[model samples]
Target chain A: MNKGVAVTGIGVISAIGNNTGENYRSLISGKHGISSPEILETIHKNLPVGEIKISNESLAEDLKLPKNHSFTRAALLGAFAVKEAVTQSSLKIDNETGFISGTSVGGMDTTETYFKDFTQGKTENSRYVRAQHPGFTTEKIAEHFGITGFVSTISTACSSGANAIMLGARMIKAGKLKRVIVGGTDCLTKFTLNGFNSLMILSDEQCKPFDENRNGLNLGEGAAYLVLEAEEELKGKPVLGIISGYGNANDAFHQTASSENGEGAFLAMQKALKIAGISSESIDYINTHGTATRNNDSAETEALKRIFSKNLPDVSSTKSFTGHTLAAAGALEAVYSLLSLQNEQVFPNLNFSYPMKTSGFMPVTKLKEKPINYVLSNSFGFGGNCTSLIFSKNGG
Target chain B: MEVKIYINGIGSISAQSGDLFSGDSARIYQENIFQAISPNYREFIKPMALRRMSKATKMGITSAKIALKEAETEVPDAIITGTGEGCKKDTEKFLENLLDQNEKLLTPTSFIQSTHNTIGGQIALNLSCKNYNVTYTQNSVSLETALLDAQMQFDEDPEIYSILVGGVDEISEKITSFRKLDGQLKSKSIKNLDLLKEDSTGTITSEGAHFFALSKEKKQNTYAEFQTLFIKNTIQPENINEEIEAFLKQNNLDSEVIDVVILGNNGDNRYDHYYKNLQQNLLKNTMQLTYKHLVGDFDTASGYAIYLAANILKSGKIPSVLKLNDIDSKTPKNILIYNQYLGRDHSLILLSAV
Candidate 1:
């Protein structure tokens, strides 16, 4: 097998915590971050969300940006996550580094706020007009990091972050660059709040992932990043984990809903296992893409059954802790997966009391300490994009 | 060992035609701001699923079906898509409803579809081909990014036989109007046929979906062999020549070997210099071609360029409408497509006649 991509460093700012250590503490303690909307100014205040407690102004101030900075909430979160990743990776911001970011709504937070103002001759908010496109958000992040080479963005819904990681690995394997930082960021907005509300998938209660009474998902906002480096370039660094394998597949079944059999999820898991040169039994834990929606939990359970047969590994949906962070979900879960491997722990799938009737699979509802080696993470999104990423301890 | 990836099958839904093979024979739209002739999406997608799909998803699914049919492949090893604006219809719908309703009682469907990867995800959901699916949205290079991913899959494993790849974009009323306000779209409507000659400051906005079934093994229906694809985030007009030279040298080919050079010129006076710089210098002697006049300009418009290149390579015949220069070749053998948007997301794609 090709030498796996080295994940030298990671950074995260999610609802559960900020940065790697904080998030790990929350995950291990089974502290669910779901709370009634505090930061997001929305009419549906009853709906729970995994919102970062920081305000945009506070974030901007923390980044030490100029007062007249046009950075959107998405960019702000992205900058924070990326800054942490860069510092953790200890890589100099030079011409050689590449930045690939995944974002669903690049600057919708600012655009939504400024859309009508532009018609009223508000030139100050007009700067956000160009930021609506996803590339502009990534460009802003690249600019902040002083990166000028191979900068790009991927916008594959929830799987965008995973796909970004996959692309970074491919670029490194192709000998394109020595180091690259890849991940995704998204700031919850009234646009997404109402968008998901219209679909009637936003649960009023804390999201009960894999629970029989699970109503729907709680939308969250945050950013997470992983710094992936070539093996030779990672000399003497603390390798957090290794991105052993990654697979992406399309459900091709519907626009938003996954298939009954979870074909895409199954295929992604299978492909990832193949790439990692491991069997289903070797996977010690699974970070499911269980949004607690009736469709997602059932479909994902079925997929797990198909991949693992009778002896499935301990599985949990961290969405209970962080909600569904959309594009950041993949990277967030990637960070959690690495933490699980590092700590040899199995995080609880909060609010899950009963298994879904279809797959009859139950999640690990209590934190358990064990010898964890390999962890599989799944993130599926609209347009039936399914991605599975396998992370393993070094030399596992 | 390296594997040669071939364009086994192709499909598209644009201003030209929804059918891949039939696009060349399709009627030429002379209007500048042409919209895609949407197919009967209900025939392909179920109502429950179709209710929430935006124009981008519908176009993406329909074109993906056509591509799969053309290749006669039931399932591909991977499904990857590139989109620039991604699910604009839903994005607009959600935004409009939010602004109009004051962010009350909105649904999740529009927001879910608004994600750029939704088209790729929806296609995967429809096909149940859960292999390797990704969506790239790097401005104009969105489609090229997907193509590059497909190429990497082929290079990584020869066992990866077939990959479904495409680029899609859609225009919504509000977004299109705002784009016009920002001078991204041409102010005046001009005939599509006269797009090149028009002295316009911006491009006529349009949308399209182009899907291709790429495989390592060339089949009877293979359109062309995708040789190499390159992308650069930024390029200056002065550096265009050097970039092209270096790109060709890295690919172990030269300008003389390229039979056709498809340029992305959308009648924008400001950025048209990027194309003019190429036409006047490095590729002056090459048989130049252009297509945005017919399809208008969008992020993934380069997909249509790929469609055009594939057709020329397959038929060995150049349509009279696409000719930008009189430099003729006996038969189109090698093709190079270069595209960008607002002078960013620069991409170069090379296709060879198989």
Candidate 2:
């Protein structure tokens, strides 16, 4: 372990890519994954989303599951990403390897499909009843990997994945576990699509993060994981990067909306900087929470100006590519942050044309190669849960 | 790096109401489902806030306040919570409206309250404690995860003083009824007091909230000190005793040193054998206690056992109503709490009198 909590390996499966390499390629090429609804059966066909082309059947077949498998689409996506993470890390999942996952809609895909059927006397798929719980998907993943220790799931809306990573680092720093595989996964369902639609936050067009004319965010689904090993457990292993600091704070202003000044966002960034033992001037890049919603972009920009002052780092919101993946957005961006560290390059924020009038800030519109040292990624969610994770280059 | 963790205060709301240690009344349960005998939520929550919260959020906030007041702490440094089917009423409302309206014209209230961390977030907002807030939702082990995180908090940070850790779940119409179809509930109504006598396939389903004010510094009214906590995702029911013995050995305590052994027994004929093996063998001579008969079985029902254990430690007295065996002990110094759900998420927690 070079420094901080060592991040040994990472894996991701999203609309833009199915693995880390694919995601990196797409990120460098500025390939936005936004498209019109193709798989989801909804009334609004014009709504754009970052939908993965693969079907649940293909995902199940990839895992060689039986026909009567109770694994939900979320669990399948989680398993797919976890498998790649395990392979990349070559880490052994034993009694000591804890697993922590973040998920919003754990298995709603299965529950919504069979809720009426089971309640109306159909009992063939009754095993899916427990899928209503978010922990169900985590249980599926833990069982798949044969992990038996300290398994937990966090659901703090969109900031869930970042909080999961935060807890993992805290666990390691506390000397509770020697190693852990932490991440998050969530699959799109009618429940969330309609939930966001009802909130009137779902955009009908491709999301343009940090753009002045951005109307709303496009919902997406995916999963990602990172292997974090403690100092004692790291014996000359290939470390991707080090998680230097993480902070979580609540806005306490609204149930679902961010404050105009982004108080929670500002506090979270300050706490992270203090924990990392660094100053704000050291952050080479910032992966903002920008969900393409007007409120989020405006508030986050104000928070950025407050934290970084006039000299803001090269900031971009990756949601322009992945369309806010809810719980998985944090970890997905964490992987992107690590990719930035390893390649010494900054990925551009796609689809951003105009700058917001209030903040008068522009996200990096083109990919830039630079000497990256540390990157800060932000994930804000409903209930005013704001979390920021800072990743430092291993040798830096 | 492990440090001593003490249960400075405790609060619970279930079929048995008020302070868990206080002798409230002759508790009786006639229905299979045990709706919590609630306190006046208005006393703990503001009028504007209480209107939007669901049953789970209301119970969680109220119980958390009771615990904090008992500990005489105004605001905890951190708030950690565990919930399985979080905000069930709001989830049901949102889902029902979504399906009924074909996903149109639905308000964001229910959707906003539908997340698993609503209770934890609401508690933090109510207290305005921005230290560290997290929520765990791993089925039955939800509360255990929270307590473990609390222990981690105290262990990692030298300055963190106190934390509010809780486990809560709520029951709604559609979700509870659907659970019946999944073979998670008893086929017929069984008297709550006679839960152990029946050879039933499933146990009764219910909900409640339990919160604890845990601190590194023990006060005169400290309930108990946490010794160790462990979890196993899956262990064979037949080999549960081995797990318990191993956990005890690792903690450097023998089985005989345990004055009270709290077991989670809900009379599920399919899974009660795990408890029977422990009660009849290793812990036969110790005072055995059961509480699901009074609290009903929920995801975080084991939290009630911790509340009971802490009271026994603080008062040096065990209520006769909770006694499963007649083992006599003047003071219970060490208590072991073991719980599992459907033979998964098995956990063992050891506590000692401060």
Candidate 3:
């Protein structure tokens, strides 16, 4: 039990791809998924967004849901990804299996559709009302998958997915559950589109993580999940990677902005490294939390430099390909980190034309192959919530 | 050695006064949805910072501060919050304004406060306590999940001394009314205090915020030990007995050892049986208590149950107003809080005298 947390299976559906295969191909071949909003209906048609191409109706049909089912788009995406993880890992989901989901806007798509109707005495659409809460979507996903065990939803803004994974690993280590399905789901909605736009952090063009000319982030929609099994229960199962370390720390600096020195980010990485019982030099790759925003990139860069001062590993952000998926970003990149280990390849950071002056650290902009043993991924969210997860090559 | 978790301080802003059950009868509720009794707020928060906060943020911050102040601790190692429908008012406001203004010229205040983690983020900013921060939004079991997380923290990191954990849910005009249509709310307006007597299909609704400063180092004011907690996404109404037995067995206790059982029965005809099955069967002879009739039902209303247990354990006396069947216990020793929503998100919490 003291060895490590084993990630037996991983599943992800992002703007770059519908499944892990497509996402991996798109990643290595330098295919970018950022484009104009096709699935999301917004006034800013010219604004680039990393939106999944499939519609809710198509997603529901893919899941074989009923016509009048109450599953929201986010639930559909989560169920879709979780199905892949469960199937890939050959995992048995019984009464002891736990489902932990991370979502910021749970079912707001349904709420926005039925809110006005509810106010006008249209009571039939009331089922969508409570679904707006982040927990409802997790419940819907769990119900869809028949995961009738302990279920919890973490909604710590952007770091939610990483936190969900952290909690699931903790629960497994505590002998609370034998296996757990953990990840996050979020769909691009007009509410978030307008909200991030209101904050003036919505970039009109493709996001450039760690680039000097980075302006802001392009909101995206996606979901990813991983099957974490107790070390004893694995029983010779094919371990994709090991969740060796996880750390969480809040910036406590501002509501939506990071501090000048990225205190929370620094502490999060430090704690994660300490938990893994490994030194900074042991990390082969670092998947950074580069949102491409003016505040986030510079702050993250500064934090990265502080943690890996003497010898920096190959660092990169895949946000350029998938955009910032908000709550799903952490889990999405976790999949990428594991993919890098499984394939022994490095995915380049797209659209980074120039390096920032603060850190002066340019991300690997070209696909390359190398032997990697450990990878560290960070996800920092609004409300100053920052989480770092260390995924190491199995049997490392 | 087993690390122990204790409830050192508690702050609550619910339908009744925060300092409830102070040698007096509990306040009765007549409305369908009970609003929390709010404090001055200015006394705890600065004016400039207070102006921008929504009702949920205000309640969360003020109650967190009260708990910290009472515990005599300045900063906690971590801050965790459980919110069912977080900042619903702000969310509705942002949606309405976005629709009205055609998604243009919208401000970020309502949008910022609308997120589920705003309260946790704001509390961190106010206290400048930068440590592990997370929020759970899982309907009825939200607060229980927070407690479970804190328990796990103590077990995983013995160095972690204290964590600020709480649950907050605010009622809004459109959202509350919308829930009525889902058959979750009572069809007709009835006196909430007489909720159990009602032959209705749904229950009353309400708003509240409750925070607690939990620590491994038991202070002089420690009310009770947070012995154990668990959350089941669901269980059949008929199968609850076995689940309770198993949970109790896990904690090395049974119904007889539980001196007081706090039941979250909001009088929903279909689901009240979940509580009555215990009130009249396994835990029937044990002292039974109910609180939703007074505070009305909300997602995180179980937080009040924890408050009730802590206060009862500290005072060594049960408030007669919360009595259900009059089975008496001279001094309440061990308390169990069981809560669920519409037959889903079942949670069990065990609190014992420290």
Considering every candidate listed, which one attains the maximal TM-score?
3
Window of ten residues with lowest summed lDDT in model 1 chain B: B18-27
lDDT of 1 at A302: 88
In model 1, the runs with Cα more than 4 Å from the true position are A92-96, A118-124, A351-362, A365-367, B17-32, B39-54, B105-113, B125-128, B197-200
Residue lDDT tens for model 2, A1-396: 125799988989999999999999999999989887777777777788888888989999998888888898889989999899889889988878989999988998888888778758688888989998888889988988888777889988899999899989988887778889898998888888888887888888888898999999999989999999988788899988999988888887777888899989999999899889899999999999999998999999989999999989999988889988999999899999999989988889988888888778989989999999989999998878999999998867
lDDT of 1 by residue, A64-177 (tens): 989888898889999999888889889866545778888888888887887787656455555677777888888788878778667778887778888888889888887777
**The 10-residue segment with the lowest total lDDT in model 3 chain A:** A1-10
Error of 1 at A316 (Å): 2.8
Better of 1 and 2 by lDDT: 2
Highest DockQ: which candidate? 3
Better candidate number, 1 or 2, judged by DockQ:
2
Candidate 1, B288-331: lDDT as tens digits? 99988878899999989999899889988788778899999778
Comparing 2 and 3 on TM-score, the stronger one = 3
Candidate 3: give the clashing pairs: none
- Model 1 score (lDDT): 0.84
Q: How large is the interface RMSD of each prediction?
A: 2.2, 1.4, 0.9
Positional deviation of B296 in candidate 3, in angstroms? Answer: 1.1
